[model samples]
Target: MSPTIGAIVIPVSDLESAKKVYTALYGEPHTDQPYYVGFNVNGFEVSLNPQGEGGPVAMTDVDDLDATRNALLAAGATEQSAPRTVAPDVRICVLADSDGNPFGLRGK
Candidate 1:
């Protein structure tokens, strides 16, 4: 089987609001809307699903979460949490769209 992160559908409270938040965060328009707002971030397929339809926050893996989070914020992505050390040589963090769905960032 081919194992890889393909796409995630996040449920937001509102599509328009989610669009604004995602656009500001991603710095681009969703591939499509009123259904799916898709984006490819660092090779990860991400789609913003409207509140009722969108499922949950889609988090991607990374090597340096602190640095990644810093970079994301610099790019206008909001930090849901600072880098949190979970285990030795490992940590995780979260970022969110304007509506508050939690997209996670992890490192080891």
Candidate 2:
């Protein structure tokens, strides 16, 4: 499947503060939870991740999460987290490139 950037996740130390800022910038969020907050701006998803360790991670959508994850691993990416269901009908996996840049793969 052709890859597409599904979401851009930002690491926020303070969830409430970040949420307020994002809310002002993107208007009301479609998703609001302790672990995550999500906003849709012009069809692009922007999310705040309170547990994120460092920089933002761009989640790419794939047709098959496992297959794409395996392919990325074979192509020199290291697994950071295995695929897991985050919400109903949504699954995601995290990986890091050779330079330790984190990214994610998402699928339904």
Candidate 3:
């Protein structure tokens, strides 16, 4: 399956403070949780990840999360996290390239 970037995650050290700033910028978040805050701006999802490092992560949408993750691993990407269900049908996992550039893969 051809995957496309569906979400952008920005790492924040302070969730509450970042929420305030993001609220002011994006108006209101569509998904607000202690771990993550997400805003939909002009059809693009921008999210704040409290557990993220200092770099931004781009989440790509795939048809099969497991297969795509395995492909990435075979292509030299390292696993950062195992697949986990975040929503009812949504599954997500993290990986990093050889240079340690982190990204995510999501499916439903």
Candidate 4:
């Protein structure tokens, strides 16, 4: 399957405060928890992570996580975080381009 830009996760210092602002713009979040607050903007996922470092990271949905990540690494991308499951049937990984700009990938 072709990759699709499915989600963008923003790292916030204060989740509650950020939740308020994001909720105002996007309405109430579909998923609200201590670790994350996720809003659905149209079909795209806009998420907030209290533990994340750096700025926002856009996640691309892929059919095969390992193959795609390996290919990216072969093409000069570096692994920032190895693939791990965040929720049921949902797995994600963080990677950086050669210049060290981080992005993410999500798969089932």
TM-score for each prediction?
Answer: 0.44, 0.94, 0.91, 0.97
- How far residue 49's Cα lies from its native spot in candidate 2, in Å, is 1.2
Clashing pairs in 3: none
List the pairs of residues colliding in candidate 4.
Answer: none
Error of 2 at 82 (Å): 1.4
Residue-wise lDDT of candidate 2 within 1-108, one digit each (tens)?
A: 699997998999999999999999889999999999999999889999899878898999999888888889999999988888989989998999999999999996
Candidate 4, 1-96: lDDT as tens digits: 899999999999999999999999999999999999999999999999999989999999999999999999999999999999999989999999
Q: How would you encode candidate 1's per-residue C-alpha lDDT over 12-42 as one tens digit per residue? A: 7777787788777776854765766777777
Candidate 4 regions with alpha-carbon error over 4 angstroms: none
Among residues 3 or more apart in sequence or in different chains, the pairs in candidate 1 whose N, CA or C atoms overlap within 3 Å are 11-54, 12-51
Clashes of each: 2, 0, 0, 0
Candidate 1 stretches greater than 4 Å from native: 51-108
Better of 2 and 3 by TM-score: 2
Model 4 compared with the native: what TM-score? 0.97
lDDT of 4: 0.96
What tens digits encode model 3's per-residue C-alpha lDDT throughout 1-108? 689999888999999999999999999999999999999998888999998886888999999999899999999999988999988999999999999989999896
Candidate 2 residue spans exceeding 4 A from truth: none
CA shift at 90, candidate 4, in angstroms? 0.9
On lDDT, the leading prediction is: 4
For candidate 2, the lDDT comes to 0.92
